[model samples]
Target: MTAALCLFLAAINIATLLAFWWDKDAARAARRRIPERNLLALALFGGTPAAFAARQMFRHKTRKQPFSTYLMVIAAAQAGGALGLALA
Candidate 1:
């Protein structure tokens, strides 16, 4: 990936991570939670790396059944694309 692409990905990841953190805080306070769709949208938009890191670090949403499954699928797809690029 080019430097610009790397930076873009990094920004996405950071945004997603912070969003996750905010959601966690919101959950604790019984506030309006960030919608799952929004989180998945961020992941699909190339934030999977940061999303996974945030999930692991915050221990948030790790136990959510279908959400975990969806995240796995996103991660798999991203990894596959990266591998294809490397092999090309």
Candidate 2:
């Protein structure tokens, strides 16, 4: 189960990395078009790390007010979750 979860996370992370790497501008623009609820669903379903990583790497949505703060918090939580999963 853990291995599957890790694989899933890795896949998502890689996808996000590729998306950001290919065309950061397009990714940022695509993000704007997506609903916040959809993004939140992705984050909640273990994609937070990828989303946060993409935000940092692509410099997308990092300058806003509440969204920036929320993303930071979510990133921290995701790190904590990953650490806990590893330790368990």
Candidate 3:
């Protein structure tokens, strides 16, 4: 909840959102797309909320197997971690 942590999260989330937008654009243009692992890494590093937002906003990667599953898992883990911190 500190200012620095909020700033970092905001920056990462914005980057994640932009990455998704770029990937969707690339997909439409048949260009080289962003890697799934990189996208997941962004989510893992505090971009989960923005990842979900981008997925819904761009309608991209919604049905991808393993990727959707992984994103959900990451979100769940993040929620649990946050809950743990709150309880602690």
Candidate 4:
């Protein structure tokens, strides 16, 4: 990947991770939680690894229904794109 793409991915991943952390804290505080769609959107923006790591680390959304499905789809898409690029 190019330097710019790498940097963008890194930033998005970090942001996704922080968002998960923030949402966890919000839940614990009984505050308004971050929307599930927003988290999934972060994954769509190439934050799959960070989102997965955050889910595992925070013990959040591991068992959720559509959320897990969305993450899986995002991961699959990223892998497929990488494989396509490699074969090209």
Candidate 5:
């Protein structure tokens, strides 16, 4: 179970990173882009680390209003959840 969970998280993070990269590329090409909700959903589903890394690496969605705010909130909630688990 632990290994499976780790594998799932790894896959999701990779997918999230690829999504961010693709979205950035699409933006540069003026093409259809990934939706903000989808990105946030990825982050909410154990892809937060990749989301942050991709944001910094690609310089994507760094200063966007509400998106940044939403990301931060999600990060905080995840952190809190992890802390609670650790404590428990």
Candidate 6:
């Protein structure tokens, strides 16, 4: 069950990344309109890594803003979670 969950999360992350990579401007526009709370919810549900990677790869949402800052924080948390899982 844990493995399945991890796989599902990873797939979602990958799909999110691909979506951003393919259309960063569209994604950014959607992201801008979407509520920060919802984005955070998505990250909390295991989408942070892809979100962060997309931000970096597309150079999107790097400006100094509360939303960007929150995304970074979530990215760090995701990294920690991944590290912990790996170590375990």
Question: Which candidate's TM-score is highest?
Answer: 3
lDDT of each: 0.93, 0.66, 0.99, 0.95, 0.97, 0.72
> When superposed on Cα atoms, how far off is each prediction in RMSD?
1.1, 4.0, 0.4, 0.7, 0.9, 4.0
**Candidate 1 clash pair list:** none
For every model shown, what is its TM-score relative to the native structure? 0.92, 0.57, 0.98, 0.96, 0.97, 0.59
The clash count for each model shown is 0, 0, 0, 0, 0, 0
Per-residue accuracy of model 4 over 1-88 as CA lDDT, tens digit each: 7899999999999999999999999989999999999999999998999999999999989999989998998899999999999999
Off by over 4 Å in 2: 15-32, 80-88
Off by over 4 Å in 3: none
Q: Of the candidates numbered 3 and 6, which has the greater lDDT value?
A: 3
Candidate 4 clashing pairs?
A: none
Question: Across residues 1-88, which tens digit of lDDT does each residue of candidate 3 receive?
Answer: 8899999999999999999999999999999999999999999999999999999999999999999999999999999999999999
lDDT per residue for candidate 2 within 1-88, as digits (tens), equals: 6798889978776765555455566555664454445554566666776777777877866676776677667778877986998999
Q: In angstroms, give how far residue 88 of model 3 lies from its true place.
A: 0.6
Give the better candidate number (3 or 6) by TM-score.
3
Candidate 1 least-lDDT 10 residues: 1-10
Candidate 4 Cα misplacement greater than 4 A, ranges: none
Better of 2 and 4 by lDDT: 4
Q: After superposition, how far is residue 83 of candidate 3 from its true place, in Å?
A: 0.4
Order the numbered candidates by lDDT, best leading: 3, 5, 4, 1, 6, 2
Off by over 4 Å in 5: none
Considering summed lDDT, which 10 consecutive residues are worst modelled in model 5? 1-10
Candidate 6: global Cα-lDDT? 0.72
